[model samples]
Target: MGNRTAVIVACALVGLTVSTPAFADSPAPSTYGRASYLLDESTGKAMISKRADKRVPIASLTKIMTAYVVLGQAKLTDKVRITAKDVRYAERGGATTADLRPGDRLTVKELLYGLMLPSGADAAHALARTYGPGVDGFTAKMNATAKAMGLSNTSYVNADGLPARGGDGYSTARDQARLAAAALRNPTFRSVTSTKSRTVASTADHRAYSWTNTNRMLDAPGSLGVKTGYTRAAGFNLAFAADRKGRRLVGVILGETDSSRRFDTARSLLKWAAKHPVEGNG
Candidate 1:
């Protein structure tokens, strides 16, 4: 493992603790996200909080729960036949997609790449229908999974995060940071989210598909895995994590108004954490 990886592992050996945003010197610059949070894994302190608890539409970030529920209930090797219904759902929603076509037989693992890296609404449908009694059952599991994880503010009406006419899933930065922390605890979820790109061959027929991760923060230094989101209702959102100097940090930014700004804010969050270095407890 690289030196940085070693530091992260070591930092994790001690329990997580969060210090107040008391900086060693000057406070970090004002941030931009409607809800922004920073968790300093070394001290376990919430080093930054800007409306971290205000509930708002969460967009595709709901997929983290979708992934968690599926991973808990399905085997990665299980073969799931893609269906016309799934593709059709994707067509109507205007969601980001990995070009999943009907009749492509993909494994659960392959579908996860579709579900996460490209944020495929079709892949979400496939996993939900295959694992749950139906899409409704699967979405119930998503909410149940959220509650079980202590995500009180989170709700899910769809496996993908397309808002229902009356309901778009809403979660606070605190709840999402909690969700991301839980997802990272699952090795498979962590590995998949951190991967920048993947090419998986359909086990049933051998057709291949490739996907790239949606979180641009993954390209930044010390960046790790997590997830991203966007919608007319949710604006641009991102849940991001990183490892630098053996410490792990989790950041969440919701409702950033646009795509590029979400990334710019996320990078700024990390830089702010690095420079501020929370110090002096009350």
Candidate 2:
């Protein structure tokens, strides 16, 4: 119940923990990203923070919020009609798409897979235009959701985190972890994110739209659903989660150096957190 004991307990849960300093109260860990944060999902306790407050590009991890807003505003069974403008916008942006095309009618549930799994931008565009009035309106709703969440270091320039003609999206690691925590609370969001592979039947013509999760961290034990992200500016950003026994933890890393490093860093952090096993955090 001492403050010193509480700090030590919290750090262990974050993983990549710092040893108790011989002369100082706190010290930073070297084995982390340019910005990183880890949280105990069950309790909302911050387990780790390294430059977690600095804002930076978040890439496809922005989809977590995109999916969040979509699920809140639309029914999963509602069918949405894709437009030529939606397909063209996504393709022209060089975004990783789900191969969705104009005339493809898919349910909001299917589109959720398109957004979370494979990190599809076309899916994001379709959902935004259909559910959001338009992409701008959806993005505005995303910002409003961030505001309601009290996220000071978060903003959405686009639904899929792709660069617009003007700018790309950005958020801090801490803010991102907070976003992931809120998102994972949704059973639907959690279920979709954790799914490794799925085939959705298009409402257009019953064509199977198969997709896979982009989060390699799922290969790790106790892995839960979250999201992945990348851009030249954001590097290999990732928002990941894992559950061990009953303990759940969320990890957010931005500006990682490469693809392999992104998953490796997350795996190591979560594994360490699992082995360390913060008390009462379970």
Candidate 3:
């Protein structure tokens, strides 16, 4: 073919290939639950959502706020000597513990590991007690922190998120997402939750105990560290994140029937989000 004819032929072939459409992108799926929201961290877009603003008990997911308070107020190197009070709080309400004892000592960083990994109510109280003038004072800090973070629907009664005297602790899916996003801002907070396993030194005897993360999403493919919650009142709740195909997404599922399905539903939601980008839903 002449040079001009050959160039025209090549251009026509390129146009034909470019004009043909590639496979259509899959659609994101809907899910069941009273309230939920999935957000793309990059674009501030909600991919899926259902009643995300309705207030509900958040269970231990409240610790995301607790983590923010402690990390913000205390320094890692500050020494926390476990008190009789600390031991009492740690052993309170039959919650899982790092077995802290009276007079045992660790840095603030170490206590945070116990606080987040096992959702230890005791460690949370201890940090609050030491950092605040008293427990009530610490709770005031938690509430104040919530307001500062624009969590209009959040209120905290205790540092550990164990059941309260009058009733359940309250927060909305949107409020919890705000807490999770705030927690993500601190490099230290990210370090604590993302960890699958950690060894916490017993304050009383200096023995080390291994505590595993309760959020099963950590085991899920592409799962990142966040938080988990459960109680008879809260059912099963979770806030999670994952990076797939260079797009990072955050998901929150509350009121799931059981622990396993909470993880399953979260995995399903994330998968759907990856395939389908829906604004103002999550």
Candidate 4:
């Protein structure tokens, strides 16, 4: 086996303790869909891979990309009006909402909190309507940014990631991982996702509303920030990252059974990755 793989196996056996154990020749869980990958931030190497290049529906995890697009185009202090067009009629009933009303005024920063913390589809639409010229216009910008970032397999349709009539919103595990890494580069993006609770002050028509992050893993001590997504078609999708002893790891698991299981898998994967310290800055 390769040295890094051998190290990971040894660490897995001994529990990442000081005394490494003999490498085990066992298979890891193969429970995932279209694509999944674990990235070693220190060496910029993908330690595990499965269909990393295949584009698939990513659900609300697409909001992270939405945040990236909006943060670049608008300032936090800017005020946005939540229009009717921004809210999606939830025929299937998706939770994690800002519950924005028409003409309610809020700062771009708070809207970001709404988007990242609650996975607010309304907030996503608000940003797109304001800065994207329209949804299609904003999607164009998203694709352009993806190309710039060398994400050849990524594409976005609706800003809220509800999935279009045909196959529209799509991304690969590798693409999502790269996007998460890039999003972390922006201090604003990192700030919003890492925070557990956000309280937006009352607007003229509404009282203060507190939104909690959807990613349960953030409740853990070392987790920095990440996004989660789900749909009947997409199953359970999650993008997760954490820091321990100054080392960071990002992982994605697509198509799981339940919400808690997805989060648990994320925590487990992150813990495992944390155990194997990569070369250099790890």
Global lDDT scores for all candidate models: 0.79, 0.80, 0.75, 0.76
> Model 4: runs farther than 4 Å from truth?
1-31, 88-96, 280-282
Arranged by lDDT, best first: 2, 1, 4, 3
Model 2, range 1-282, lDDT digits (tens) per residue?
Answer: 766666666655544344223112433333445788877767666666767788888889888899999888789889888888888887898989887868978888888988888888889999988767888898999999999999988989989898766877779988988888888888999899999998977656757888998888777887876888888888888888988768888888888887878788788778766655454432
Estimate, for each residue in 1-282, the C-alpha lDDT of model 4 and write its tens digit.
776577566544532221222224333333345567777665676655667777788899889888998989888999998877666532234645678777788899999998888888888888888888887899889889999999998888878778678675888888898889878878888888899998888576557878998888887667867898988878889898877667667778776667688777677667665666555421
TM-score per model over all chains: 0.87, 0.87, 0.85, 0.86
The candidate, 3 or 4, that scores higher on TM-score is 4
- In angstroms, give how far residue 160 of model 2 lies from its true place: 0.8
User: What lDDT score is found at residue 103 in candidate 4?
Assistant: 72
The number of residue pairs in model 4 that clash at the backbone is: 0
TM-score of 2: 0.87
Please identify model 2 stretches exceeding 4 Å from their true place: 1-32, 203-207, 279-282
- Considering summed lDDT, which 10 consecutive residues are worst modelled in model 4? 14-23
Off by over 4 Å in 3: 1-27, 277-282
Q: Write the per-residue lDDT of candidate 1 for residues 1-282, one digit (tens) a residue.
A: 755455444433432222352342443445565777777766666876677778898999989889988888889888899889898888888888877888888888888889999999999988898888789999888888888888888888888889888777788988888778777878898888989999987543656787999888887787876888888878888999887766677888888877888788778768767765554322
